[model samples]
Target: MKARIHITLKNGVLDPQGKAVAHALESLGYAGINDVRQGKYIEIDLAKNDADTTRETVERMCRDLLANTVIENFTVEVG
Candidate 1:
Protein backbone atom coordinates (compact mmCIF):
# COMPACT_ATOMS: atom_id res chain seq x y z
CA MET A 1 0.00 0.00 0.00
CA LYS A 2 1.20 3.41 -0.95
CA ALA A 3 0.04 6.27 1.18
CA ARG A 4 -0.04 9.92 0.28
CA ILE A 5 -0.39 12.34 3.15
CA HIS A 6 -1.17 15.98 2.66
CA ILE A 7 -0.55 18.25 5.63
CA THR A 8 -1.75 21.81 5.73
CA LEU A 9 -2.50 24.64 8.10
CA LYS A 10 -6.09 24.86 9.25
CA ASN A 11 -8.41 27.60 8.12
CA GLY A 12 -7.91 31.00 9.82
CA VAL A 13 -4.22 30.30 10.45
CA LEU A 14 -1.81 32.82 9.02
CA ASP A 15 0.63 31.56 6.38
CA PRO A 16 3.49 33.97 6.13
CA GLN A 17 5.37 31.95 3.55
CA GLY A 18 2.32 31.66 1.35
CA LYS A 19 1.66 35.33 1.72
CA ALA A 20 5.17 36.14 0.65
CA VAL A 21 4.77 34.00 -2.44
CA ALA A 22 1.52 35.68 -3.27
CA HIS A 23 3.09 39.06 -2.88
CA ALA A 24 5.93 38.09 -5.16
CA LEU A 25 3.45 36.88 -7.71
CA GLU A 26 1.60 40.16 -7.59
CA SER A 27 4.85 42.05 -8.06
CA LEU A 28 5.52 39.94 -11.13
CA GLY A 29 2.28 41.26 -12.72
CA TYR A 30 -0.01 38.42 -11.72
CA ALA A 31 -3.60 39.43 -11.07
CA GLY A 32 -6.80 38.13 -9.61
CA ILE A 33 -5.05 36.26 -6.81
CA ASN A 34 -7.44 35.40 -4.01
CA ASP A 35 -5.58 33.44 -1.35
CA VAL A 36 -2.64 31.14 -0.78
CA ARG A 37 -1.45 28.67 1.83
CA GLN A 38 1.67 26.57 2.08
CA GLY A 39 1.44 22.84 2.63
CA LYS A 40 3.35 19.55 2.41
CA TYR A 41 2.67 16.34 0.57
CA ILE A 42 4.28 13.14 1.85
CA GLU A 43 4.18 9.86 0.00
CA ILE A 44 4.61 6.54 1.79
CA ASP A 45 4.83 3.06 0.37
CA LEU A 46 3.37 0.25 2.48
CA ALA A 47 3.22 -3.51 2.08
CA LYS A 48 -0.48 -3.91 2.71
CA ASN A 49 -3.66 -3.17 0.76
CA ASP A 50 -6.18 -2.34 3.46
CA ALA A 51 -7.24 1.31 3.52
CA ASP A 52 -8.98 1.25 6.90
CA THR A 53 -5.95 0.02 8.78
CA THR A 54 -3.72 2.25 6.71
CA ARG A 55 -5.87 5.25 7.49
CA GLU A 56 -5.70 4.57 11.20
CA THR A 57 -1.96 4.03 11.15
CA VAL A 58 -1.43 7.11 9.03
CA GLU A 59 -3.52 9.20 11.40
CA ARG A 60 -1.50 7.96 14.32
CA MET A 61 1.71 8.66 12.46
CA CYS A 62 0.60 12.19 11.67
CA ARG A 63 -0.43 12.87 15.24
CA ASP A 64 2.71 11.35 16.68
CA LEU A 65 5.45 12.63 14.40
CA LEU A 66 4.52 13.84 10.93
CA ALA A 67 2.09 16.69 11.70
CA ASN A 68 1.23 18.84 14.69
CA THR A 69 -2.44 18.33 15.40
CA VAL A 70 -2.86 21.66 17.15
CA ILE A 71 -1.97 23.89 14.18
CA GLU A 72 -2.36 21.59 11.20
CA ASN A 73 -4.64 19.04 9.58
CA PHE A 74 -3.83 15.97 7.46
CA THR A 75 -5.54 13.81 4.90
CA VAL A 76 -4.41 10.23 4.30
CA GLU A 77 -4.82 8.50 0.96
CA VAL A 78 -3.74 5.14 -0.34
CA GLY A 79 -2.41 4.37 -3.78
Candidate 2:
Protein backbone atom coordinates (compact mmCIF):
# COMPACT_ATOMS: atom_id res chain seq x y z
CA MET A 1 0.00 0.00 0.00
CA LYS A 2 0.99 3.57 -0.56
CA ALA A 3 0.04 6.38 1.79
CA ARG A 4 0.38 10.09 1.42
CA ILE A 5 0.05 12.49 4.32
CA HIS A 6 -0.29 16.20 4.17
CA ILE A 7 0.43 18.03 7.42
CA THR A 8 -0.36 21.68 7.86
CA LEU A 9 -0.57 24.20 10.66
CA LYS A 10 -4.04 24.86 12.05
CA ASN A 11 -5.67 28.20 11.71
CA GLY A 12 -4.93 30.86 14.37
CA VAL A 13 -1.42 29.52 14.81
CA LEU A 14 1.43 31.87 14.10
CA ASP A 15 3.30 30.72 11.02
CA PRO A 16 6.51 32.66 10.70
CA GLN A 17 7.83 30.48 7.90
CA GLY A 18 4.65 31.00 5.93
CA LYS A 19 4.82 34.68 6.58
CA ALA A 20 8.39 34.78 5.37
CA VAL A 21 7.45 33.03 2.17
CA ALA A 22 4.65 35.49 1.57
CA HIS A 23 6.96 38.40 2.14
CA ALA A 24 9.53 36.94 -0.20
CA LEU A 25 6.93 36.48 -2.86
CA GLU A 26 5.87 40.08 -2.57
CA SER A 27 9.46 41.20 -2.73
CA LEU A 28 9.88 39.19 -5.92
CA GLY A 29 7.00 41.19 -7.44
CA TYR A 30 4.35 38.54 -7.02
CA ALA A 31 1.40 40.70 -6.22
CA GLY A 32 -1.97 40.19 -4.56
CA ILE A 33 -0.61 37.73 -2.04
CA ASN A 34 -2.76 37.95 1.04
CA ASP A 35 -1.27 35.07 2.98
CA VAL A 36 0.77 31.89 2.81
CA ARG A 37 0.90 28.72 4.83
CA GLN A 38 3.60 26.07 4.66
CA GLY A 39 2.98 22.36 5.06
CA LYS A 40 4.63 18.96 4.92
CA TYR A 41 3.94 16.17 2.45
CA ILE A 42 4.93 12.66 3.38
CA GLU A 43 4.76 9.45 1.33
CA ILE A 44 4.95 6.05 2.91
CA ASP A 45 5.05 2.52 1.47
CA LEU A 46 3.48 -0.31 3.38
CA ALA A 47 3.29 -4.06 2.91
CA LYS A 48 -0.38 -4.16 3.82
CA ASN A 49 -2.76 -3.98 0.86
CA ASP A 50 -5.93 -3.05 2.73
CA ALA A 51 -6.95 0.57 2.31
CA ASP A 52 -8.76 0.81 5.65
CA THR A 53 -5.84 -0.64 7.57
CA THR A 54 -3.38 1.57 5.76
CA ARG A 55 -5.37 4.66 6.56
CA GLU A 56 -5.71 3.71 10.20
CA THR A 57 -2.03 2.98 10.59
CA VAL A 58 -1.09 6.19 8.86
CA GLU A 59 -3.47 8.12 11.05
CA ARG A 60 -1.79 6.73 14.12
CA MET A 61 1.58 7.61 12.70
CA CYS A 62 0.42 11.13 12.13
CA ARG A 63 -0.96 11.45 15.62
CA ASP A 64 2.14 9.96 17.20
CA LEU A 65 5.04 11.35 15.22
CA LEU A 66 4.21 12.80 11.84
CA ALA A 67 2.28 15.84 12.98
CA ASN A 68 1.90 17.92 16.14
CA THR A 69 -1.71 17.36 17.02
CA VAL A 70 -1.81 20.53 19.13
CA ILE A 71 -0.94 22.85 16.28
CA GLU A 72 -1.14 20.85 13.09
CA ASN A 73 -3.73 18.85 11.18
CA PHE A 74 -3.15 16.01 8.77
CA THR A 75 -4.95 14.40 5.87
CA VAL A 76 -4.19 10.84 4.86
CA GLU A 77 -4.68 9.21 1.49
CA VAL A 78 -4.14 5.56 0.74
CA GLY A 79 -3.76 3.70 -2.50
Candidate 3:
Protein backbone atom coordinates (compact mmCIF):
# COMPACT_ATOMS: atom_id res chain seq x y z
CA MET A 1 0.00 0.00 0.00
CA LYS A 2 0.96 3.61 -0.45
CA ALA A 3 -0.09 6.78 1.29
CA ARG A 4 0.16 10.35 0.13
CA ILE A 5 -0.18 13.25 2.50
CA HIS A 6 -0.64 16.90 1.64
CA ILE A 7 -0.11 19.33 4.49
CA THR A 8 -0.99 22.97 4.08
CA LEU A 9 -1.53 26.05 6.14
CA LYS A 10 -5.12 26.87 7.03
CA ASN A 11 -6.83 29.90 5.57
CA GLY A 12 -5.94 33.25 7.16
CA VAL A 13 -2.54 31.96 8.24
CA LEU A 14 0.58 33.93 7.40
CA ASP A 15 2.86 32.30 4.83
CA PRO A 16 6.20 34.04 4.75
CA GLN A 17 7.81 31.54 2.43
CA GLY A 18 4.92 31.74 0.03
CA LYS A 19 5.01 35.49 0.15
CA ALA A 20 8.70 35.48 -0.67
CA VAL A 21 8.08 33.25 -3.65
CA ALA A 22 5.32 35.53 -4.89
CA HIS A 23 7.57 38.56 -4.56
CA ALA A 24 10.32 36.78 -6.42
CA LEU A 25 7.97 35.91 -9.22
CA GLU A 26 6.84 39.51 -9.55
CA SER A 27 10.43 40.67 -9.63
CA LEU A 28 11.06 38.24 -12.46
CA GLY A 29 8.26 39.91 -14.50
CA TYR A 30 5.48 37.43 -13.91
CA ALA A 31 2.12 39.13 -14.04
CA GLY A 32 -1.42 38.60 -12.80
CA ILE A 33 -0.44 36.49 -9.84
CA ASN A 34 -2.84 36.95 -6.98
CA ASP A 35 -1.42 34.67 -4.30
CA VAL A 36 0.83 31.81 -3.47
CA ARG A 37 0.75 29.21 -0.72
CA GLN A 38 3.44 26.69 0.06
CA GLY A 39 2.85 23.24 1.50
CA LYS A 40 4.36 19.82 2.16
CA TYR A 41 3.76 16.64 0.24
CA ILE A 42 4.71 13.26 1.64
CA GLU A 43 4.56 9.77 0.17
CA ILE A 44 4.90 6.67 2.29
CA ASP A 45 4.96 3.00 1.40
CA LEU A 46 3.10 0.72 3.79
CA ALA A 47 2.86 -3.02 4.27
CA LYS A 48 -0.83 -2.85 5.14
CA ASN A 49 -3.12 -3.49 2.21
CA ASP A 50 -6.42 -2.36 3.66
CA ALA A 51 -7.28 1.13 2.48
CA ASP A 52 -9.35 2.02 5.56
CA THR A 53 -6.63 0.94 7.99
CA THR A 54 -3.90 2.60 5.98
CA ARG A 55 -5.77 5.90 5.90
CA GLU A 56 -6.32 5.76 9.62
CA THR A 57 -2.66 5.07 10.28
CA VAL A 58 -1.59 7.92 8.04
CA GLU A 59 -4.05 10.30 9.68
CA ARG A 60 -2.56 9.37 13.03
CA MET A 61 0.87 10.09 11.68
CA CYS A 62 -0.28 13.51 10.59
CA ARG A 63 -1.90 14.27 13.92
CA ASP A 64 1.09 13.10 15.93
CA LEU A 65 3.99 14.55 13.94
CA LEU A 66 3.55 15.33 10.29
CA ALA A 67 1.25 18.33 10.60
CA ASN A 68 0.64 21.08 13.10
CA THR A 69 -3.03 20.57 13.81
CA VAL A 70 -3.45 24.05 15.22
CA ILE A 71 -2.39 25.80 12.01
CA GLU A 72 -2.16 23.19 9.32
CA ASN A 73 -4.66 20.84 7.69
CA PHE A 74 -3.76 17.53 6.12
CA THR A 75 -5.44 15.15 3.73
CA VAL A 76 -4.49 11.49 3.31
CA GLU A 77 -4.82 9.25 0.29
CA VAL A 78 -4.20 5.52 0.46
CA GLY A 79 -3.99 3.07 -2.36
- What does each candidate score in C-alpha RMSD? 1.1, 0.6, 0.5
Error of 2 at 74 (Å): 0.5
For residues 17-59, write the lDDT of model 1, one tens digit per residue: 9999999999999999999899999998877789888878888
Highest-lDDT candidate: 3
Pairs clashing in candidate 1?
A: none
At residue 7, what lDDT does model 1 achieve? 98
Ranking by lDDT: 3, 2, 1
Question: Could you tell me the lDDT of residue 2 within candidate 2?
Answer: 98
Model 2 per-residue lDDT tens digits across residues 1-79: 9999999999999999999999999999999998899999999999998999999999999998999999999999999
TM-score of 3: 0.98
Cα-lDDT of candidate 3: 0.97
Task: Using TM-score as the measure, name the better of candidate 1 and candidate 2.
Answer: 2
Off by over 4 Å in 1: none
Which residues of candidate 2, in runs, are more than 4 Å off?
none
The pairs that clash in candidate 3 are none
TM-score for candidate 2? 0.97
What is the Cα-based lDDT of residue 51 in candidate 2? Answer: 99
Number of colliding residue pairs in model 2: 0
- CA lDDT of every candidate: 0.91, 0.96, 0.97
